[model samples]
Target: MVLPSVLNADFGDLGGELQRLTDAGARALHLDVMDGHFVPNLTFGMPIVEGLRRHTDLPLDVHLMISDPLRYAGPMVDAGADMLTFHVEAVDDPAAAAQSIADLGVAVGVAINPDASMDQLEPCLDHVDMVLIMSVQAGFGGQAFNPIALERLRSLRNQYPDLLLEADGGIKASNIADVRAAGCDCFVVGSAILKSDDYGKAIDELNDQIASANPSGANISPGQEATR
Candidate 1:
């Protein structure tokens, strides 16, 4: 599934931007909630996520790159986050955090940074619905894609075989196939889609590409190809 990260969307016209993406066939919305202390920047909070919830029917894939994620997990779920992800580096008890988020009836996810290993997520894989592998450092958009992460995704695929592996950071139409082949099923694209002059066209092209790559049309594999 292709989720367009709202971090790069135009805040001045959030509703319009969201609607455009939704209309363009985006299945999910990726919300990056950051705290300056955890990552070097700060982004949307619970209220904003709640507001976005009312604008679209698509599932909200919330990535919380903040400290004390356990403290904020409940509120984010209550505010309508369908799937919540917290950095593995941000919490001490990642399993507990995943459980807390799951308790709210929302899917749980764990994000591993560029420098973090897939081994760090091994203990908590069963508790999460997905594992987000960052292709670049957190807190910024439009950064270069780290090719090393591809190897990590391949490793995760070989190990888990059933976990949903998502890739975020520097994902665009041009490199979607490379990442897909490397074991990424869900893609979180930021500036690539939101910053484009032809947002709708770009999204269409991406979806078409994804479909072309996986003709079997099965749901996306945990780390391999996306099921059509």
Candidate 2:
């Protein structure tokens, strides 16, 4: 599934921007909530999520790049977050954090930075519904796709075949195929879609690439071949 991040969207017309993505066939919206302390950048919060909820019915996958997600998770959930992902490096206890978020009745997820390994997530994987692997350093947008993420994704796929693995940051049509082939089922894209001249066409191009890249054709069935 393609989830266009709101961080790069036009703030002047936020609602229209979100609607455009939905019209472009994006199934979900990636809301990056950053606290200045945790990520060196401040971004959207519950009020923004609340406003976005009134604009679109798309599921909000809220990525909390904050130091204290335990304090904000419930508020985000109440603000209409369908899924919440917190960084493993942000909290003291991943398992407890997962349970706390899960207790709020929303899908829980764990995110790891490019330098982190699967071992960091071992304690919380059981409670998470999805895993977000940062393809670039967190807290920034429009960075280049890191090749190392592909290797890590492959290892995760090998160990957890059915887990919903997501690749976030620096994802575009150029690398979506490689990421999908590396075992990512979900994509968290930002500028590629938001910065495009045509939202729907950009999304279609990404979908086509993902579908064609599937070797087994189990996940996506496309008419054209995915170009490397």
Candidate 3:
């Protein structure tokens, strides 16, 4: 599913932006919450979340890139975040942290950086609802998608048939097919959708692109790792 990231959206006109996305066939919205320490950046807090809750009916797929995910999970969920994805690098016991957040009546997702190994992320797979493999470093948006992410996704998909895999960073109409082919069920799109001339049309094009990609396996053709 194409989950448009708020990080790249027009905050000045978020209401209209949300409406446009909903009309463009978006099933959910990806909200990136960054703390200055954990991600070297700062973004939406609970106040923003509370405000965002009233604007859309689409499920809020909140990604917490913070130093203290467990401490803030409840507040974010309480502010109407439907699903919370916390970075594994921030916590000591990822598995336990995942369950602790899950207990807040929301589906838990765990995110891993591009440099993280597959085995390091596997321990939390059984406990979380989804796994978000960051295609770029976790701090900011609009960075290039790392080719290593495809290998990580491929390895994870090959090993866990039931797990839901997601990919974020530098994904757009061009390389989306490759990412999908690499076994990402959820696509967290940012500027790819936001910066387009026609947001709805761009989203439609992306969805169509994803629909056309082979879903059976990571039949990655030689040198298919896209630069975009």
Candidate 2 deviant stretches above 4 angstroms: 215-228
Which wins on TM-score, candidate 2 or candidate 3? 2
Query: What TM value does model 2 have?
Result: 0.93
Q: For model 2, how does the per-residue alpha-carbon lDDT over 106-127 read when each residue is reduced to its tens digit?
A: 8888999998766889998887
Model 1 whole-model lDDT (C-alpha atoms): 0.82
TM-score of 1: 0.92
Show the colliding residue pairs in model 2: none
Q: Which stretches of candidate 1 lie above 4 Å from their native place?
A: 217-228
lDDT of 2: 0.84
TM-score to native of every candidate shown = 0.92, 0.93, 0.92
- Sorting all predicted structures by lDDT, with the top scorer first, yields 2, 3, 1
lDDT (10s digit) by residue, model 1, range 1-228: 788899999999998998888777777889999999999998889998999988777788889999888889889977888888899998788887788777887777899898876667867887888889999999999899998778888988888787788899888878877777777779999888998888788887777676676654225422222221
Model 1: colliding residue pairs: 217-227, 217-228, 218-227, 218-228, 219-227, 220-227
Minimal lDDT window, size 10, model 3: 219-228
